[model samples]
Target: MTTLDLDFVRSHFSAFNEPSLAGWSFFENAGGSYACNQVIDRLTNYYRKTKLQPFHPFPASEQAGREMDAAINNLAAYLNVDEDEIDLGPSTSQNTYVLAQAFLSIMQAGDEVIVTNQDHEANSGAWRRLTDRGIIVREWRVDPETGYLDIAKLDKLLNDKTRLVTFPHCSNIMAHVNPVAEISAKAHAVGAKVVVDGVSYAGHGFPDVDALGADVYLFSLYKTYGPHQGLMVVRKDTREALGSQGHFFNEGLVHKRLVPAGPDHAQVAASSGVTEYFDAVHAHHFGPQADASKRGPDIHDLFQAHEQVLMAPLLEYIRSRNDVRLLGPENPEERAPTISMITNRDGRSVAEDLSKHGIMAAGGHFYSHRLFQGLNLDPEAGALRVSFVHYTSPADIQKLLKAMDAVL
Candidate 1:
């Protein structure tokens, strides 16, 4: 099993040394990961040097544009998709909204869309709006007790009318990792497109979008230890069907088609930092054998193995606690490192108590209202979410457990 180098990770993050926040063990990585110092340094240097508008006629602007393009291409390669298939947006929420609008032109009245109650509002609300246009919205509900989506029930929900199916690759609230390959195959068998909300899964490891058979996959860069931006991959064939939401002049620009909003140049430039951090982690653990040049399945597997080892103890501990009700699978194999749980008391109170003890954690619906509702959790009460990334240490988990003992 691969063990995380805590000393090496701590050195990479300056936040660990802050005296006032000495006890603060951040466990809210599912919402947003702490930016790596290497990533921050690159962004700071870029800001100091150029900070000019990209894609212009000037040499400096052209170079800046090339850097941004390289970032997009790198991310696309990681996702196992062509360069033209990728699009960068301000946030996952914005990307979904834009995708919904793009589908509006192609979807006729009475066409159906399949959505899961286990998704974040970003995935649900955008597609749900189709109800206004006489488009049928079918909800695949999760089992209240297990918080698992009933794929067999989904078999009943799909039909010829189904044009698109939206679900989370891994839910933020339930912390359930859906079987994307299985579900995608089912959706494809019926001629429906699969759209996966990958924000939660992406932090644990990069996924192969093509292998998952998702027509479109969306994730937030902020949650993956990079800049606050959204990364979206739409299959080239699907991109051809969706009409441009941008200006009339840019209709042929496939990347800008679904995104009505223009790109954030600096954030786009900074996104390469995520790949940089991943490369560093791979090299640290596996030595120079880490091939940063490779993408897709191989790199994703390497990262996933690293994360699984780091998260094992936390999952085992949560399973042993009768006082805690875990939202998803008790088994680590069925989920990501995001541990969502409900205690005997209000989750927010538990979070505050943890904070007082110098543990950085959070409690709330995490914008996954539908999921909380499906699980019969009060949106206001929420659930305590303790998530970890590749850089998270075993010591951090122990610190969180120690805090939990005092709070619970």
Candidate 2:
């Protein structure tokens, strides 16, 4: 099997060689990754050459419209979803907020929606707020000790009245990869729709939405090393079921329906760069391929294999430490590269100390306050999160281990 070419991977991201960023090991990728040159070039070119009112009957406008359409089509192909099923919006928080409005129009009083504490506030708060409209918002809480969501608990919560179930593909803090297909299957059996927040998971690999079987899937492009846009896929049946949130004229357009705010043409156009980066990776390892869908899994496995190797030593180190509590599974195979730890010392101070040695990481509740409270962690103190992606090298991990030793 072909392995990931790390040299080929790091070369695509200009940030690695920046004068000010030299020698700095970036582990805050879950917050947002350093964009690849493909994204930067596309974004910059869009602004310079094709900045115009897209879809208009003119030269620049036509080019702008084509670029935006290519972005959606290419990305949709990679996910194995129809282009019409995809919606690009400002951010994941904004996308879910708008989507909640559509759900509100359909859900009747006494109907239940289950949300997980393991989710970021972007996914949890929006659905929970629907309780104001008389919908019964139920909490599918995570295990207080392990920070893992139990499907058995979810099974108890689902019933005839359960209209929707919202959870993460993986938690930003816990990093445990959820069984999205299995969870979606259970929800489907209960006649409920599954809304997946893929922001954390997509940084490791973009999912095959069709196979995952979610009614609605969402991820942020910025965190995926693309533009700052939220990409959502609403299955055809789910799109038709929800009331339109867009303007009256766009009611019949599946892509336009949930986006109340008009699309950002330039950013949408630049998003094609994400697929460009993926294609480059696929070609470098496995040779040129015309099929984006086929390439998706191959590339995903390659990246995950590389990440797991780098993640193993870090997981072992965290498990051996008695001074801090590791948040999720100690095995790297069970999670993404996003690792969190709660310490006796202040998390923020530890993060600051790590920064002095040029290790870029973050410390916070990460907007999952309810999850923190459930885990018996002080939300005010939060926890230290050290996350990375495929571009991260073994040498970088060594620097992080040394910095962590000195700081903690």
In model 1, where is the ten-residue run with the lowest total lDDT? 289-298
Query: Count of backbone clashes for each model?
Result: 1, 0
Task: Write model 2 residue lDDT over 1-408, tens digit each, in one string.
Answer: 677789999999999889999978999999999999999999999999988889889899999999999999999999999999999999999999999988887789999999999999999999999988999999999999999999999989999999999999999999999999999999999899999999999989888999999999999999999999999999998889899888999888777899888899899999999999999999888887898999999988998999999999998898889997888888888999998998887677789999999999989899999999989889889999999999999999999999989987
Q: Which residue pairs show backbone clashes in model 2? A: none
lDDT of 1 by residue, 1-408 (tens): 555566776677666776876757788888898887766876786687658988899987887888789888877766767889999999999999999988888799999999988888999999999899889999999988888898899999999999999999988876778899999999999999999999999987788787889999999999887888999999988899887899999998777787777888888888887777666766776666533445334456655666677678777888888999888876667778888888887777888899987777888888888877887779888888888776677677788878888888
Prediction 2 TM-score vs. true: 0.99
For all predicted structures, in order, the TM-scores are 0.94, 0.99
Model 1 misplaced regions, further than 4 Å: 1-3, 17-20, 287-299
Candidate 2 local lDDT, residue 222: 97
On lDDT, the leading prediction is 2
